[model samples]
Target: MKKKYLIIGAGPTGLGAAHRLRELGADDLLVLERHGHAGGLSASFKDDKGFTWDIGGHVVFSHYEYFDALLDSLLGDERLEHQRESWVRSCSTWLPYPFQNNIRHLPPQARWECVEGLLPGNRPEAAPADFGQWIEGVFGTGIAKYFMNPYNFKVWATPLELMQFGWIGERVSVVDLRRVLRNIILERDDVSWGPNNTFKFPLHGGTGEIFRRLAARLDGFIEYGQEVAAIDASARTVTTKAGLTVEYETLLNTAPLDILASRWLADRDQTMVEAADRLTHNSVYVAGVGLDIQREAERNPRCWMYFPEQDSPFYRVTNFHNYSPNNVARPGRQLAFMCETSYSAHKPEKLDELMDQTIAGLVNTSLLDAARAADVLTRWETAVDYGYPVPCLERDGALKAIQPRLEALGIFSRGRFGGWKYEVGNMDHSVMQGVEWADRMISGTPETTYRWE
Candidate 1:
């Protein structure tokens, strides 16, 4: 088979590209998806018990107008808007999200420690070199010790020193001594600091509904269950594991860049393999625990909570039922908890025992009652091999070496893992990367979201 454009992995990026290509009057494009379904990491599932759950904690918030417009067009009135009520669990108490800003909620001793560390010259004077140092320099020893250090390690599953600080743009809420003190003195709840303060959710299905509706617009263009096996870049051809080969004038890869470079490419060299080796990522295990709401105290207004302490194996847990009433079988009468635990070589976890560990964690963190363990209606879980694309010290340098070389061969890699950029790997950014790539391909418009430099 031959096509003008070929895209691998029909996730947000591939679907977005196909949608835009068609909109721009280009029909000679095809998207290859390994799974029989679409949505990639954003996909949702319904257990036999009728509870819907996403892969992890995914909230629909955008940094792009085009992405917002696309979502508006796709879901229309089928979506629900939500005010983010996020919190942090530390010192066996719940504090507002961005723990540093709400140190007042902590016990007097812990709160004073946070403030004392932020005083005049307690923090490091020199410019920080890594994420670990940056956390200390910016948040001070107290905040880092209480929240940032442990929470980040649990989420990233990587040593903070090995990771770089460039990726912490809007993702982290950076606070200073004055801001910290003022919030405490003024007794203010500084919860509305981030871009996802107000977000949207699908009223019926989980977060995947947005992508599912988008994929439907480009029906015949996407070929499901066709995982790419090898790509001869020089020949501009791709071979799938199902023994089908397709030649293309141009290719867009929405899969992991490391795998594309090290495992897929037929003519890859030493530099490409070495560059690929430097691109590190952490795997995630998402456990969805659901049960009937037995008591009034079982419901909470908070959307999600972070676990910085070792009491919970999971770093984050989303009150999935709060996002949409339709998430559970009985709506307001049921509860759905989606917990995420990340693991990597730096922080190994017993995947086999994580579900049980997660349940125990929920109880330990006070989300679940110890006696209600037997009442769980469903325990749905999935382990994703490529969860977060780690912003390692060598990531930028590796991308600089690999991306340009691939682009020279009429191949473009974009999206979350494809671009290997955690900073712009959100759903909106991933889709726009593909849309921009399509624009660049068809009309010579420059791509902006995932710049290797």
Candidate 2:
């Protein structure tokens, strides 16, 4: 069978394209998803013990009005708004999120180190060459050594020196030195920071419900359980794993660009192949721990916490039950936590021992009391192979070489990994990438987010 537009992967990007195409009066379009269901990495699952968990820690926060309108239309009353109460676990004390901004929470020696390093004329005047240098230049040795260094290593699974700056944007908060000193001098907390300061979640299902409902709106358009095996770009044809060959005038690929370049493209040049090979990504281990009883009062209010120290195997832990009551089967009778531990070739993890390590980490961090360790009701674990796209020093070069080459062949690769842009890879951006791509194809509107310019 053939179609005018063939979108691969029913994730946000593909769904966005599908929705926009329908609105633009395009009929000969189809979406092919590898999984039996849609949502891609944003999907959720319910464990036997009646606890729901997302692929990792995902929340609904948007940077676009269209995305807000689409979500509101889909999950209206099912959405639950949350006041993001995030914290960082450091030196046996809970420091507010954006660890650099709240130096007062640290011990006497640590606080002094951070403050002294931040004193005038301490940092270098020149621009930082890499993420490590950027951290040292912006935050000084104390915040870099104490939190940014270790925490970033855990999260990125790549050496800081190998990564470039400029992708941070609003993801990482810049410190206000005067405010930090004032807070330390006044004995106050500077807790509010970052884009996720306030977000939303599904009241009944996990984060997946939004995407599932989105997929439902375009029910007959998606063909599930069919992975794209290969794409003959020159011939404008795609062959799925199920042996279905579909031809299209334009192809919007939402799968990883590396996979597209190195695996799927039948006539890939060595330059494009090697450029794709340079792309790096980390894997995540999501562990869902369901407790027999509700969390203690203090813990109940804490939405999520970060772990930078080596005492914990997981980098971040989300108080899932605190996000929404429907996360657990029994509501007030049960509590849930979703822990994310990242790993890669740079930082390896013993998957066999991950569960035990995560459990021990929970107890070590005081997230779970030692006495109630046995009260753990569910231990569900899932591994996502493509967690975060690393912005290595070579990322821009690779994207420059790869994206243009694919686009030249009428293949628009856009999405989280598909576009290989972490800065605009959020849910809103990913969907808008698709939306803009459809607009580009239908009405000749120039693509914004995915364009190199």
Candidate 3:
């Protein structure tokens, strides 16, 4: 097969590129998806029991007008808007989402410790070199000890010192001594600190519905169940595991850049291979626990909660039923908890033991009662090999070395794992990366969302 453009992995990035390419009057493009279905990490599943769950905690919020317009065009009235009600589980109590800003909710002793650590002379004077030091320098010892350290470790499954602080842009709510004290004194919750304060959800399916509808419009442009096994960059050709080979003038790779460089690329050299080795990522296990809503207490308004302590094996759990009533078997009559636990070489977890551990964790963290364990209607779990693209100390350097070399061969890698940038790796950013890549390819528009430099 021959084509003008060939895209690997029909997730948001690939689909976005294909959709935009068609919109721009380019029809000679094809998207290859390994899975029979689309949506990639944003995908959702409906269990046999009729409960719907996303791969993890995914909320539809965007920073791009194009993404908003795309979502509006795709979902229309089939989506639900939601006010974010996020919280933190710490000190045997629930505090508002930004734990530092709501230190007043903590017991007096813990609250005092947090405030005391933020005092004028307590924090370090020098600029921090790594995420671990940055957490301490910015949040102080108390806040880091109580929330930032443990919660980040649980989420990233990487040693904080090995990671860089550059990715914390809007993802983390950075607070200072005055802001922390004022919020406590003013009795403010300070819940609205990030971009996802107000978000949208699909009314029927899970988060995947947005991508599903978008993919539907592309139709024949996408070929499912085709996993690219090898790529001859010099010849601009791709070979899939199913024994099909396609030659293209240009290629867009939405697969992991490390794999594309180390395992797939036929003419990769020592520099590309070494750079790929420096790129690291953690795996994630998502457990969807569902049950009949037996009591009024199960109908909480909070959307999700973070677990920073050892009581919960999961770092985060989303009240899936709250996102949309249709998520459960019975609308507004059942509960679905989508829990996420990340694991990596730095923080190894027994994948086999995680479900039981998660259930026990839910009970320990008070989301589930000990007696209701037997009443669980569904305990569905799925594990993804590439979860979060870690912003390691060597990440930027690795990308600088690898991306330019790939682009020189008429191959462009963009998306979450493809770009290997967690800072701009949200659904909106991922899609825009593809859209921008398409624009750059067809009209010579420069790419902005992702730049290796």
Candidate 4:
């Protein structure tokens, strides 16, 4: 097959690029997807018991107007608006989300420690060199020791010192000293701090509906169940696992960069192997537990919750049923929770026991009552090999060398793992990466958001 543009992976990025090409009146493009369906990591699943679960806790939020308009055009009135009601489980207490602003929920002694460390006398002189240092410098020793360090470890599956902090951007909420003090004094909860404060969700078909709809518009352009087995950069061709060959003038890859380097480009460039070896990421275990019961009144309307303690294996759990009633077979009669746990070489896991551990975690963290554990209807578990692109100390240097070489070969790798940029790895960012890559190819527009440097 010969095409003007060939895209690998039918995720948000590929779909976004295909959508843009259609909008530009360009029809000579082919989108090849490994899986039968679209959405990649953004895809949602319905378990045997009829409960919907996102790959993880994926809430619909954005930082781009294009993404916003796209959502409006695609979802229309099917999008359900939500006011985020998230919380943190610590010391058997449910502190409001943004734990830094709600220290009043902590014990008096713990509260005092957090407040005293924020005092002027305890201020540090120099800037932070690593993530751990940044945490301590910004949140002080108490918050770092109590919450930030352990919670981050559970999420990132890497030591803080081994990771860089620049990728945090808007993902993390910086502590506001005055707001913290005032909230503590006035007994107020400051839960409104992140871009996801007000968000939206699909009213049906889970989050995957958004991408599936986008893919639907492309009609016969998408070739599903055709995995790219190899790529010959010199010939500008892609070979599928089915032995089909497709030729392209420009290639947009949304596949993981490490896989692309080692599998696709290894014979072409030996340097890609070394560059891929240095790129680090963690694997994730997403456990979706469906219960045969109504929503518990105590946790009603709760969107998601975080667990920082050792009693649970999961770092975060989303009340998936709260996001959309259609997620369950019978809206008010069933409930669902999706638990997320990450593991890497730095933090190995006993994969065989992860499902059991996740269930125990739900019980341990009070999301599921121990007495009602027997009422669990279905348990679905899936693993993603590339959960998060680790912001290791050497990541930027690796990307700096690897990206330009691929781009020189007429390949634009721009997506979550393709760009290997977690700061801009949300749904909006991933789609925009594809859209921008198309713009750059068509009109020589510079990719401002996902820069190679």
Q: lDDT of candidate 2 vs native?
A: 0.90
Worst lDDT window (10 residues) for model 4? 291-300
Residue-wise lDDT of candidate 3 within 1-453, one digit each (tens)? 999999998899999999999999999988999999999999989999999999999999998999999999998898999999999999999999888889899999889888888988999979999999999999889899899999999999999999999888888888867888788889987887889999999998898898899899999988889999999988889999988899999999999999999999998999999999999999999999999989998789999999999988999999999999999989989999999999999889999999999999999999999999999999999999999999999999999999999988999999999999999999999999999999999899999999888
Q: What's the lDDT of the predicted structure labeled candidate 4? A: 0.88
What residue runs in model 1 are displaced by over 4 Å at the alpha carbon? Answer: none
Which segments of candidate 4 are over 4 A away from where they belong? 294-299
User: Cα deviation in Å at residue 408, candidate 4?
Assistant: 0.8
How well is each residue in 1-453 modelled by candidate 2, as lDDT tens digits? 889999999998999999999989998999999999989888999999889999888888998898899999998887899888889999999988879888799999998889877888987779889999999999988898789999999999999999998899888998778989899889887777878889999997798888899999898889998998999988999999999899999999999989999999997899999999899999999999988774455255888899999999999999998888889989877878899999999999998899989999999998888888787889999988999999999899998998888889988899998998899888889889999999989899998787654
TM accuracy, model 3: 0.99
Residue 213 lDDT in candidate 4:
92
Clashing pairs in 3: none
**Candidate 2 all-Cα RMSD:** 1.2
Tell me the lDDT of candidate 3. 0.93
Runs in model 3 lying further than 4 Å from the true structure: none
Note the Cα lDDT for every prediction shown.
Answer: 0.93, 0.90, 0.93, 0.88
Backbone clashes under 3 angstroms, per model = 0, 0, 0, 0
